[model samples]
Target: MMSFDLIGRLFGSVRDRDGRADVLEKLAQHEPTLPAPRNPSAPEELLPVALATKVLAGWLANRQQTLVPHTLNFRVLGPAQADLLLAVMAAAIQADGEIDSREARQLSLALRRVGAGEDEARRIGAMLAEPQHLGTLLTRIQEADLATHAYAAALLAINRGTRVNRAFLDYVSARLGLVPDVAGSLERRYRA
Candidate 1:
């Protein structure tokens, strides 16, 4: 089975400047590896049950697919991993050194959507209510995709009529080990 770590590295490599050409070269040189199917019977302790259920439900809803609860295919994220993802996002929301009502609402909605308990969500909120250091939060990610997604989420929070700091963005991209172009693309897409 292709491990998540390996998958993350592969994704990072392919997200570089010559990503498409690199992918074609990789395909020509070797057989592509596929990820293992999501095993519903696998232990669910990796992710909190409520969170996992919510993720599965959202995925199904997006695809307009219906399946019995017990038979749904969902990838389970470790509790620590999930927490790190949320923390990174929280840091992003607070990246500009302030969290307005709109940002707070966005964070609350995100926490609820992920099925976080009030106490846990509040803890995260409290931590982010203060000034956040991008490097500190980016250090928590072990996977490139997680860092990328978290950064994307944070950018969304501050991309409205606000001046984004280029240095902060560059620092974050470097801390997360993302290709420069990927960060550039995100900046172009989200910059107001």
Candidate 2:
């Protein structure tokens, strides 16, 4: 989920480190080896990732930047988590029963550029059926962090003013067991 192109967009310094062309080139050149999922019961599971997020979140807060950007990296995601993100992104784009849009095209391009293969793309296309698919995706999210990430990704994918988009988000919030306040906070971050 942590697409280098995405990380490059959010963090200018990272993009600048090797030059823009080089950063995108890395995406095509190397498929990042995502680490296997950690034992959830263990306290130190993905400690570096958690710490890095905390640090970036803190740094962004200090600089008056929105928290949304730092939290969007899917690089640390395991297979199930990655699938969930792709599914939600596709669902949001298709929620209103219409999938033709610039957003849909952009997502397709991003997913491909990030090296999503034919299988995952097919799964995402199949998963746009709604309530059941959304429920199925939510179940794969065991960690609270993952649930939050998926919800955030959905929020980013959606056009909030659309009735179907709003409804899809409402269902996702309830199904994910995200409390109203936490859900509101996530929404507000994207709204900003």
Candidate 3:
């Protein structure tokens, strides 16, 4: 419920303008809202699995909507969809030929947030370790909403630091059939 409310507030905040900074601030401020698991020894003590997934999904949707509204919808994704998203992100992170430490760390954090065990996360990582035909994967996404959200996730993962992975981004965008300007806008927002 708290996650749902947070997502609603996040959507409202981003509706009028580019509220990415605001959304990030809210995510940081509201992380404490996620309840701890019943098992004291659980790895995800800082954030609940469901809540974390919702937060990530909301952020992706917000990013997509802010940059390209027609293709993506701002909504929380279910667990299966989250797994697919993680796979896409993993592929994106590896798109540049080598996985940077920061990108690996980010991917690990995302996997943990979805409550993926080490083996499961490794499985997902292995599945995407090789260069993948992003267009084929995009087609398997079923819904336009998920595909767009996955695109946003890929963009977030790939556009790190001073240099942008333009070639890789362009390839994925072309595979996804995104307008050049929309993909450029998403890249620019992160670059700024």
Residue 90 of model 3, lDDT score: 70
Q: Whole-model Cα lDDT per candidate?
A: 0.57, 0.69, 0.63
Any runs in candidate 1 off by more than 4 Å, and if so which?
Answer: 1-75, 112-120, 129-133, 142-145, 165-167, 180-192
| lDDT per residue as tens, model 1, 72-101 | 011244566555666666666665676777
Indicate whether candidate 1 or candidate 3 has the larger TM-score: 3
Tens-digit lDDT track for model 3 on 1-192? 777877787777745455347676657885465676567576667468779889888978677555565322213556567666666777777677787777767666655544555765766677665676666667766454565667666765654552446666666677777777677665665331
Considering TM-score, which of the candidate structures 2 and 3 is the better prediction for this target? 2
Residue 175 in model 3: shift from native, Å? 1.7
lDDT of 2 by residue, 1-192 (tens): 667657756667444553457656766687777769756887677788799999888886654334334355555666777777877777677777776575566566655544566776787777665543555567776443577777877776656787778898998888888778678877877551
> Judged by lDDT relative to the true structure, which candidate is superior, 1 or 3?
3
lDDT of model 2 at position 61? 62
What's each prediction's TM-score?
A: 0.44, 0.49, 0.46
Report the error of model 1 at residue 179, Å.
2.7
User: Which run of 10 residues does model 3 get worst, by summed lDDT?
Assistant: 69-78
